[model samples]
Target: MSASLYLVAMIVIPAIGAAAVAALPRERGLLAKQVTLGVSLVVLLLAVLATAAFDVDGDRFQLTTSVSWIPDFGAEFALGVDGIALVMLLLIGVLVPLVVTASWHEADAGPRPTRVFFAWLLLLEAMMVGVFVATDVLLFYVFFEAMLVPMYFLIGSFGGPRRQYAAVKFFLYSLVGGLIMLAAVIGLYVVSTSQLGEGTFAFDALRQLDIDPEVQKLLFLGFFVAFAIKAPLVPFHTWLPDSGAEAPIGGAVLLVGVLDKVGTFGFLRYCLPLFPDASRFFAPFVLVLAVVGILYAALLAMGQTDMKRLVSYTSISHFGFIALGIFAFTTEAGTGAVLYMVNHGLATGLLFIVVGMLIGRGGSRQIGDYGGVAAKAPLLAGAFLVAGLASLALPGTNSFVSEFLVLIGSFPERPVFTIVATVGIILAALYILLMYQRTMHGPPRGVLLQQDPAEPLSGTGTGTGTGTGTGGATAASATATATRPAAPGTLRVLDLSRRELAVVAPLIALIIGLGVYPQPLLDLIEPAVSATISDLGGTDR
Candidate 1:
């Protein structure tokens, strides 16, 4: 197979699938879901093939294929991948299948049209791949903005009770950022015209232009504001928590897992390369916001009562590290940021799946509603614990490696920021353990702890001298409820269902696998990272 074939297939296959899914008869509910799953898997295969075809050690972008789209404006239907882009493609590829699997029965959840949900997901995947692969700045912006349509509907139509609000908030924030970015794209085109005698949005062309320092800062702000909103640095991060909490598990997975990465990807791909002086000039201010985000978001996460919201806050905290790594201007820090994006997807994606399971059983996302779940479902508890540990960057987990690299690589260049960000590590432990202890360790509220408890508990579980909880069943004792009958009116909870296990098993393996052996990914990422740093005119500190 030709190299362009893999890159082209990654986008085309999903576009074709979206069309096919949209054409499916509404009556064929199962067929719609199955077809979407199959297409996602095929795209994933293409991603793997693309990885195989990618020249990881190559100094320039590989598999580049461009065709004129607008000769008058100097735009084209161009595509290619650097090692960084390849990693992102692979991340999206892996996440899409799992998202399809996680949402296998999601059509049954809300009142929206099931076929539309599947179609939108496929559409989102195509655009995401396009964003990562596009070589022209205009094309990137187009995909960047266009991808929002599917996600907006995905949340508004298939999300929770507050879905519409979250969707609109997400849309408005993104639109504002996008409009700002449009101005920058226009600015770059003008610069290209001044330098090359005709306007162009080609990334390579823009990189070659000699831009004025003042103008570079202006253009960089336009781009930085958009990416910051998307990277969602601190003050600009409100939409994320709202969207993550309200969207379906599948949407949340891509929203937090993949879509958000576009912001950071834009930084590495566009900001640094196109405006090196502006990047260095702005690094200190960006570093300050990143450090603040790491602490502020972690504190907020600790105080959250809702499970999804807590995880969302943690991601914000994690993004702080990603941003810190990028601006730290070290190859190690940048590579760690890239790896962190991939590993964050695995750890947090798994966390969302685990949270979905809990919500499905508990019927509430409130942390106060659940307790002592480990006694009822060890498999589920164990999986949740693994995800939690990964999120906290526990030793021997994938997150540990990335987090360690970010801090260590950043210290020499930005010692103060690195030290402040390190405090998030302790905060991570506090929040992850707190959520686990409350949800998995305490006496469960709704289900029987075991086959039977020593004594059948009465209403509210007050027999153990505790107040009432949400579900019909309640238990306050650690060991007293193992043999008691389920409280009247509450359903007995079972362990992780087969389908649920299928969704999370691969992620668990990856969390452990990458933690111990991250060299493979690092090797691919380091060259690309070195190239990005070189573009920024920086040396590894």
Candidate 2:
């Protein structure tokens, strides 16, 4: 198949797979899961091949193909990828399979049919792929709006007790943003018509239009609000905690991992290139939001009792760094922002997966309910610790390099904002370590030590009470007594199974591998970032 066809197939195959999985016998949940996994693996392979075929020093957009769709309006069913889009595509590719694997037993808790769950997941993947590859602004908007359907179902049908509420909130927030963007999309086409003597929604064509300064600001606000809500900066970020906490682990992973990146990606792909004057005009205001998000979200994360909610808040703070990098108008920061998108997905996705496993074992999302988990499940605790440390951007982990790049790159351009944002790292360390200590250390308590009320304590004597001061003899007798076997609901934690290990192994490898050397990813990202900076009339240094 030709290279452009590969992009089309990456989308079509999973969509077809979703239909096929949905058609299978309702009783064959295991088969549906297997088929979904197989489909995701195939897509991953295609993504890898596409990455390999991508020439780093090539056209701004590669593997491109366009077919006219709405001739009167100058819209087309166009598709392609630049370095930024390609890396995002690779992220979608890597994550979907891991989510499928990690969610093996996640569907069992929900009332929905397992086939439907996997099917929705497959469909969501296809939509995510479409969003990144779409070259036509109209095509991109359709995919952007279309993504809400599967995710809505994923949360509303298969999420926690408040699934419906959370799903509605998520949908409404995104829907409102998308509608505002719709106005901007229409406005953009109008400007194109006036400038070029014809209407068009092709991104390449629209970027060349010399829009009026005032008009650009108005149009920029419409697009910026939509992306801010989607990127979920402060004030617009309330929906994420509810949605993230209520959605199934698999849905939550994709929600925070690949889905959130769309907003920041939009800013890079659309806002800067299309309205250079407007982007520079609004840089200071955006930088304020970015710095505020880093500090504010980090504080919120430290106070969360729900494990999933805590992780989701961390993503908000991480996104601030991405926004800062983008507006800094420097190659180092913009490239770091792109790389941060990929690394955050890996690190935070792994964190959610492990937290899900912990909740599965202990039967609670409350951090107060778990203590000394390490004693019973050392491997699981170790995985959670690694994920937590990576979340905090510890040295030798993937996030550290990206965070480093973002801070250093943004500093020269926006020193005060960069300095304020750096404080988030200290807060990050405190929250991650405190969370790990509370959940993994301390004396075994709560679920770890719940005992039958009828059963005697481990150090107690059999129906004997001594009021006398023979403490030495009593202590010796208690030490010599045999320990009782554990009863149900007590000390039942088990270590990670083979399948669970298989799920996390690749993420762990990537975390360390990319941390040690990020040059390969940098090579693919830097050229594109430089091109973008050049367009913005900024110097990399």
Candidate 3:
């Protein structure tokens, strides 16, 4: 099949499934789960085929599709895939199925479970695919901004106590940032028309147009600010913690896993090559911000007591690494940054899913609420530990390789920033291990020990009793103890269920697989990155 058909199928399949999920009968909740999973799997398969069909060695956009959407403005329905887009598309494909499985229980939870939750999830998948494959700046922008809607609903409706607030904050922050980007897109379109005698939103065409250095700088800032808000570097990052903390586990996974990459991807795809002079001029300042973000976010992550919030802060720090690589302007660093995008999604998405499971079982997100859970839930604990280790970039894990490459690649160009960013790695160890210790170690506290009072006693002789000597004797003892129960003993923690294991097993395998042999992905990304650097008139290192 043609790549354009595959891309269209990627979008339409999920959208059609979403509609089907919305109409499915509640009694057939299992059907909804199957359909959602089926759609996601198909999308993943298509994305794989798209990757296979992609001409990595060609060093030009592949599967090009264009149609005049607005001829006067030179806007076209342009779509294509480079190596970067291919990687991101693969990520979206991999993550959506995991997210579907993660949220499988939600389909059977409420009175109308199949209708709302599954539908929103499918819609979100469509938007994410659109975001990665779009080639026209306007089309990309539309998908970029359109994503906020499904995400807002996902968080607001299916999430935690603060879901409403988090959703609103996330929506507002992204909306403002996107409006700023829209203005910049318009400016770019207008400038192209004035200078080249034709307006265009085609990325390659815009890249070829020469604008004034001053104007380029201004245009660059417009694009930079928008992506910064999404990348959420430093001051613009406040929304992520709240949103991640409150979003449903699947929602949080995609939010951090896929959407956040749009920011860094923007820098690589548009900012650096299209505005080479401005990118060079702004590199130092952006590197400063990226380094500062690394340290600041790591420190903030260290102080977080909520597991989700801690993970969110860690994302901020990871994105700092991506931003640092982009500004470093080396091919190796840039490629590592791209790799970092995929690795972060896998490792952190696993963290969110595991933490969400912990919350479901323990009934709270407070760090003090859990202790010695590993004693009972050894399998779950082990998975959490592995995921945490990956987050901390331990060797033999996917994150370690990407982070190592990024640091080595950036060291020459931004030594001070690289050195400071390395400290963030140290801090990453502190925060991830500290969180692991608090939740999975020590003794259980808080609500892990609550007992039910209404159950009738059986031969076991617990709770209320039937007529029997032992039961009567125990009843008197229980009454006496009810006045002042002894301090809670060690709590029971259940190991991960087969269902839960199914959700995270693939992620663990990939973490190991990619860590041990990442050459396939590296090979795929290199040619396109080299071309991007050459376009900016830089030597590929």
What is the Å distance of residue 196 in model 1 from its true position?
0.8
- Count of backbone clashes for each model? 7, 0, 1
For model 1, how does the per-residue alpha-carbon lDDT over 1-541 read when each residue is reduced to its tens digit? 6877788888888889999988988777678889999999988898888888777767478888898988989999899888888889889988888888777665544565578889999999999999999998999999999989999999888776678999999999999999999999998999899889999988887888999999999999999999999988979999999999888878998999999999999999999999999999999999999999999999999999888889999999999999999999999999999999999989999998888766655445677767878887899899999999999999899999999999889999899999989999999999999999998886556444332322211111121212222112332332244334467434455677677788889999999999999998888888989988988888664
RMSD (Cα, Å) for all candidates, in order, is: 6.1, 9.0, 7.2
Task: Estimate, for each residue in 315-382, the C-alpha lDDT of model 2 and write its tens digit.
Answer: 99999999999999989999999999999999999999898777655445677766888988898898
Question: Each candidate's lDDT (Cα)?
Answer: 0.84, 0.84, 0.81
What is the TM-score of candidate 3? 0.92
Better of 2 and 3 by TM-score: 2
| 47-117 per-residue lDDT for model 3 (tens digits) | 99998888767747887777788787787877788888889889999999988887766433322355677
- Which residue pairs of candidate 1 clash? 371-444, 372-442, 452-482, 452-483, 452-484, 453-483, 453-484
User: Residue pairs in steric clash, candidate 2?
Assistant: none
Off by over 4 Å in 1: 446-491
Candidate 2: lDDT over CA atoms? 0.84
